[model samples]
Each structure stands twice: as structure tokens, then as C-alpha cells.
Target: MLRSSIYHRPKNNFAYAYDEETLHIRLQAQKGDLQDVTLIHGDPYIWENGEWIYSTSSMKLVGSDDLFDYWQAIIRPPHARLRYGFICNDGKESLTYTERGFFEDVPTHCHYYFAFPFLNKIDVFSPPSWVKDTVWYQIFPERFGNGNPKLNPTNTLSWGETPTQSSFFGGDFEGVINHLDHLIELGINGIYFTPIFKAMTNHKYDTIDYFEIDPHFGDKETFKRLVDECHKRDIKIMLDAVFNHSGYYFEPFQDVIKYGESSKYKDWFHIAKFPLNPGNQLSYRTFSFEPTMPKLNTENKDVQNYLLEVAEYWIREFDIDGWRLDVANEVDHHFWRLFRNRVKAIKPDAYILGEIWHDAMPWLQGDQFDAVMNYRFTNAAIDFFAKKQTTVEQFQNELVHVLQSYPQHVNEVAFNLLGSHDTARILTVCEEDTNRLKLLYLFQLSFTGTPCIYYGDEIGMTGGDDPLCRKCMEWDENKQDLELFHFVQKLISLRQQSPAFSKGEFSFHAINESLVSYRKTLGDEELLIIINPTNRSLKVKFPTSFADSIDLWTNKHVSNDLMLNENEFVIMRKMK
Candidate 1:
């Protein structure tokens, strides 16, 4: 046996309480080194006649990455406490593993095993339940619509003009209010807007003021009306909070620049040296070397109080539903923890989504963000569906790794997206192949987590990265691809109506280089999703036995054999 391959830690993702009653435990071994693993667990205090009573549960091979195979099992400890160890086996030999060390046989003493002292309900990661059901629409506010052409900036180009980083098309709160019916028709239940606070640029990531809406977007009353209108339609609104840094022109940063070391706000930012220099050369900390965005010193108490007030003021004043924090990874955890307390106190169900592009396990422990901008999901989808850089098996493995990186509840509410303001549009990334784009959307809408659609994505808008991706919303019915829009609408409707699509257990049934098949099962309702990413027609076998099935997409009945056309996908529901 490859005993050295066995690995386990008693905390974090490996072993953590999923809820007050349920405990999730995991073990990792070198890829393909172990045939199976069994978790032997029980309460540490439960001893009768000098013997510790225990229960054994088989651990399934949940996921495997390039180097490791992950084994997982969910257990319920009667008293909310657990002592556990693993029994690993290869085809040829078996070994016992425990907290103290590896053993030849099961240890008789309970002290030798790992222990979870108690499961605290307070520590369990709990995001708002509404998030799982939400279909998010991400809007770059300045480009969404021009409801008030009067508010257009001096250099504003006509609507539908290609966007530049500094272009202003006068998309305001009134524009969003006028288009509530459009989002309603699109089946979007949640709207995530980029930074809308007063700022110099059209994109508005750099904030000049946190409390007031930008003049380009609208005034306070206009925003309140927009929030009211959205709530009437049952659409939740999430505004962006850019607390990681402030714009160069922000009052505090400007004061620092003007007064140098004598400024009372000198400690508000990270200054490498006094007499601030705003250029390519090093001086103060900035966001990605951009001198215009000076990083905030969140550790400062005054800074924390100011930002926290900004956090609570919006929720209390506008009745906003959530906050999507920008550059959240850069902010101090202490500030976020306090931020969570302040926000949740006013609205317990308010969703806090962080803009974290990478692994966010550290911030997702029920203390900070409810979810993050799932850029990992975007990268994987692009690699598999757009770039064809990975095989079906490899894509499935990577996806499984992502899912297993967090608890099941966290995975359910993860903010999954295909394109965003920061990246190339999905259509552009797919080389303008609408078929590939459709396949990508099909997978995204049906997969786990809360799926987000970048504005203009469903309408077949295509552009390159950054400023290009932030183009104006195409409102002309004649120019929009209504077919693609309806297709996406159907996907959203299916996600809403079917429990199997939203809350089902996922497993790959069959996988290959060109085609992949997966199943989402929840009790009696089972759905099979099959995709063909290649250009040639292929005959793919159904991995599960089915007598009669209806294609959820087209309502076509199927029996025995299935043939998929080039770039086609299908979701089938088994009929009893």
C-alpha cells in the first residue's frame, strides 16, 4: 500500500460542520492509490464498559485532481460531537489511519482518533436561502440603457456606440426603472450592478463618494424609485461596494496628496513615503499599480468606521437587497467581519457577495461573503466549451474540484458567471460561434450554483475584453437576437420550475473527448444533460436505463437510442 499518500486535516474544507446536525469529513490520497476509504466515527464520550462505541460509513470518491483523489462522507453525530478516523484499502492491503499516526489495526483507545469537540451552529456557513433560487443579471450601469438622454455627459456619444474606458452614455436609475419589465421578461430575479457611487469614470469602480449616487447614474430619489420598482417586480437589487481603494480624486486621498505628512488623513492610505507621487514610479500602494486607485488602509479604525457606515447607510436608506464587494480579497478580514455584522444586523437575509476571482475558502466561512464572483467557473467553462483546451474528463475533474473546495451549501449559492465587465464577452471568446455560446449557456443555466448573465450576453452582443466588453445595451428589437434571448429564457424557466435542475445531486454518467453526459437527480425527478461540443454529428449512448423520456428543451419523446447533431445539447426527463 502507498501509505505515504494518505492525508487528512481535521479542519477547513477537509472536515467541517455543514450544519448543526451534519458533519462533513474528507480524506485525500495520491491519485488512484487507494481503492476505497471508510470513516469510523462516533461521539468521543460515548463509552460503555470501557469500550468506545463507533459507527462506520463508506466514503465515496467524490473528486480527483491532477495529484489527489478526494474521499468524502457526510455524517450526523447524535450529540453534535465527533471522533473519527479512516480505514484505507488498496486491492492488496489495508491500513488504519488516525490522528496520532498510522496504525496496523484500529486503535482501541479513543484518544488516538481525531476529534471535533462540538458542532457549533454559529460556525456553520449559512448564506441566504434566496440566493440559490436567484438568476442574477450583471449590468454595467453606464451601458445598460439611456432612459434620460438629458443626463448624458458633454462628450457622450450616441447610444449603441462602442464603449471606451472613459465614455459616458448616460445610463441612469431611470433607465433601469424603465427596463424593469425587460429584466422581468428575461426571468432575472436578481440584478448585480457595477459600482454606481459618485466617481470620475463611467465604469465607476473608483469611488469619489460612497453615500451618493453618481450624477451620470441618478440622484438619491431616482435610485430609491428604482429599488422600489424592482421590489414590486420581486427583483432583488445588489449594488457594488468598492472599499478596497479610493479614487485619486477622493477627498481623503486628495487631502493626503495636498497636505503630505501633516494631513490628519495621512494614515487613511498606505504611503510608502510622504509627499505622495501619483505616477508609474513607486510611492503609495495602489490597485494593480494604478496610481489613480490608492489602496485604503482598512486596518485603521477611522477607515473601518467610515466604510462600515457606508455599508449600513445604503441598506438602511435605500432598502437594497445586497452588496457585491469589489476587490474584496484585498480588504482586511477584520473589516469584512465587522462589515458582515453591520450589514446583517439591519437585514439578516441580505446577500454579501465578494469579488474574489480565485479560491475564496478563507472568506466564505460564514463570517464574510455569502458567495463570490465565480471566475473559476468562467475559466473552466471557457476552457471546455469555448477554447476546447480540455477534454470532457479533465473538465469534469476540475469542476468537481471546484465543487468540493467548499461545503455543499456554499456550492449551491456560488455566483456562477460566464462573462463579466472584466473579461471578453462569451460570444467573442467563442470566436463568434453562436452554437458554442448556446452550449455554454445551456451548461451554465443547468449547473449548480446561482448563474449570472452578463448584460447583452443573451442578446448575442460580441466584444473583446475590458472596454469592448462594456458596450452599450442593444435595445433595438430589430437588432437584438431574440432567438438567443428566448433560448436563454427557456433555460432560466427550466431552472426555476424543476427541482432536479436547481437542487439535485450531480454526477457524470458518461464522458469522452467530444461528448459528455451528466445526471442531476433529486428523489424521483431525474434529469440527464448531454452535450456535443464538436462539429460532426455523433451517436452517444445513454449511461442509465430509461424506457420513456421527454426532452425538456423540445418535449420530444425518446426511446433507447439518441443521436446528437453538431453543437447540440439536450436535457431529458425520465417518464415513469
Candidate 2:
């Protein structure tokens, strides 16, 4: 046995309370190093005359990447408090693994094993239950729709006009209200809007005031009506919170500039010198050197209290469903913990999403944000499906690493998005190929985590990154790709109707270099999804026993031998 390759941890994703009664333990080993693994667990306080009492539960191989094979064991600690270790096998020899080191057999003393002191239900990392079933739509307010032309800013372009970093088209809450039916018909249940607070920029990431809605969007009453309308339709609304920094025009930042060293709010920002000087040298820390966006000092107690109140006031007053914290990774974890407490106190189910673009395990421990904008998914999908820069095998390996990075509950509610305001539209990434975009959508909407569609992406809207990607909504059906829209709409409908698609265990199977196959299974319900992204037609084989499974797209039984054309796919689900 390769003792050096065996590893286990007692907290976070490695070993966590899946629920109040159940504990999910995981182990990592060099790929193909271990033949079988078992969890040797027992209550810490329970012991016999000599040996400590224990039970062994076999661990199932859950997933693998290029370097490691992951194993999982699910067991219920009778007392919710336990000590555990792993027994690793190499087909030739068996060895017991413990906190100290490897031994010939399971340790007799409880102190030698990894300890999960107690499973407090409060520490179980429970996010909102509704998130698992939601399909999110991300809207950049300035580009979505223009229902009120009267609210247009000076030099505001017409609806459907091209977008620039400085351009505004007057998309408001009333416009969102006018177009709610479009989302309803598409089966979207959650809307993740970009920052809408009062700000000078059209994107609104720089917040001049956290308490007020941008006048261009609408007054507080109009937004209230929008939220209530969405709730009536069973849709959840999540607005962006840009507490990471304050805009140049923000009151506190302005006060600091006016008073300099004697400013009462001087400590609110990270100003390096007394006299504010931007022409010679940038003295204050700003958001990426933009003098307008000054990063907030979240460590300051006054700042924390002010931000926490802003987090709660919206939920308490308008009954908003969620807050998507912008640049959340830069903000201190302590402030987020306080933010979570205050928000949850007002509304227990309010989804707190963070704008984290990478590994966010630290913030997802259930005391901070509920989920993040899943940019890992964006990068992986782009490299494989959109750019064709990676082989199918490499794509599968990247996905495995991402899935194993967090616990199953976190994965269930993790925000999954293919494209957002920060990236090129999904269709453009596919080189304007509707077929390739379809393949991307099929995988995203069917995979675990709540999927989000960037506003104009459902149709065939195509643009590059940043300013180019933030184009106006296509409301004219004559100019839209209605065919692609229907295809996406159908996928959303199928996802909402099938439990296997919305919330299910996900796994990928390696085929040849071009074909992709994955399974989504829940209880006895299972869905086998196959996609062929290459140009040549190919025939894919499914399990022989699944010959009579219903094809989710056509609602007809398909044969074991399935042939898929270029960029073709199928979703086959077994009858429950």
C-alpha cells in the first residue's frame, strides 16, 4: 500500500455533516492506487473493556481527476459525535490509516482517529432549499429593456442600440415588469440582476448610495412592485450588493476628499497619504486603479455596521429574495459572517450569492455567502465546447476537479453560469453557431447547481467580452433567433419537470475524443445525457438495460444504439 498517497480530513468537504443525522466522509488517493476503502468510525466516548468500539462502512469510489481518485462514505453517527479513520486496500495488502499515521490494523484508542467533536445542526451548512430547483436569468439593467423612455438619461441611446462602457439605454424596473412574461414563458424562476444601486456608471458596480435605487432604474416603489410581481409568479429576485467599494461620488469618500487628514470618515477608505493626490501618484487604493471606485475598509467597525444594515434593510422593506455581493472575495470573511447573520435574521431563505470567480470554499462554509457566481463552470465550458481548445477527456478531468472541490450540498446550490456581463456571450463564444450553443445549454441546464442564463444569450445574441457583451435585449421576434429560443425554452421546461435534471447526482463517462456522456441520477430516477460536439456523425452506446428509457426531449423510447449527428445530444430518463 502507498501510505503516502492516502489522506483524509475531518472537516469541510472531506468529512462533513450532510444533514443532522448523516455524515459524508471523503478520502483522496493517488489515482488507481487503492482497490477499496472503508471508514472505521465509532462514538468517541463509547468503548469496551480494552478496544474502542467501532464500525466499518465501505467507501465508494466517487470521482477522479488527472492525479487523484476520490472516495466517499455516507454514514450516520448514532450519537452525532464520532471518531473516524480509513482502511485502505491495494488488492494485495490492507493498512489502517489514522490521524497519526498508517498502522497494521484499526487503532484501539479513540485519540488515534480523526475527531468530529459534534454535529451541531446549526453547523450543518444548510443553504436555502429553494435554490436547488431554481433556473436563474442574469440581467444587466441598462441593456435588458426600455419600458420607460421618459427615464432615459441624457444622450441615452434607443432600445436595442449597441452598448458601450459609457452608453445607457434606460432599462428600468418597469421594463423588467413589462418583460416578466418572457422569463415566465422560458420557465425561469430566479433572476440575478447586476448592481442597481445609485451609481454614476451605466453598469452600476460603483455605488454612490447603497440605500437608494438608481433613479434611472426607478423609485423604491417601482422596484417594490417588481419584486412583488416576481414573487406572485413564484420567481426569486437577487440584486447585486457592491459593498466592496464606494463610488467617487459616495458621500463618505467625498467627505474624506474634502477634509483630508481630519476627515471623520478618513478610516472608511484605504487612503495612504493625508493630501489626496491623483495627478502625481495614486494615494488611495481603488478598484483596479480607477480613481472613481475606492475600495471600502470592511475591517472598520463603522463600515461593517453600515454594510450590514444595508444588507438587511432591503430584505426587511421590500422582501427581496437575495443579494449578490460584488467582489465578495476581496471583502473580509468576518464582515460576510455578520452580513449573513443580519440578512438571514430578516429573511431566513434570502440567497446570498458572492461574485467570486474562483475556488470559494472558505466563503461557502454556511456562515458567509450561500453561493457564488460560478465562473469555474464558465471557464471549463468555454475551453471545451466554445473554444474547442481542450479534448473531451481533458474537459471531463477539469469537471471532476471542480465537482470534488466542495461538498454535495454546496454543489447543489452553487450558482452555475456559462456567460455573464463579464464575459463574451455564450453564442459568440461558439462562433455564432447555434448547434454548439445548444450543446452548452444542454449540459449547463441539466447539470447540478442552479443554472443562470445571461440576459440576451437565450436567443442568438452575439457579442464579445465586457462592453460588447452588454447589448440591449432583443424584443422584436422578427429579428430574434426564435428557433434557438424555443430550444432553450424546451430545455428549461424539461429541467423544471424532471427531478433527475434539476437536482441529481452528476457524473461523466469518458468515451472517445469528441463524444461526451454524463449521468444525472436521483434515487431510482436516472438521466443519461450524450453529446457529440465534433463534425462527423457518431453512434453512442448506452447501457443495455436502459433500452426502454424515455427520451426526455421527444418522450419516446430509444434503442440502446443511439446515433448523434454533429453537435447533437439526447437526454434519456428512466421511468420513476
Give each model's whole-structure lDDT: 0.88, 0.89
Model 1 lDDT vs. the true structure?
0.88
Counting clashing residue pairs in each candidate, in order, gives 0, 0
* Candidate 1 lDDT over residue span 186-282, tens digit each: 9999999999998999888889998888998878989889888889888999999999999888999988888899999999999989778877786
Residue 253 in model 1: lDDT: 90
TM-score (all chains, Cα) for each model: 0.97, 0.98
lDDT of 2 by residue, 457-515 (tens): 88789899878899888898988898998999999988878888878899986555578
Clashing residue pairs in candidate 1 (N, C-alpha, C atoms within 3 angstroms): none
Candidate 1 regions with alpha-carbon error over 4 angstroms: 511-513
| Model 2 misplaced regions, further than 4 Å | 511-513
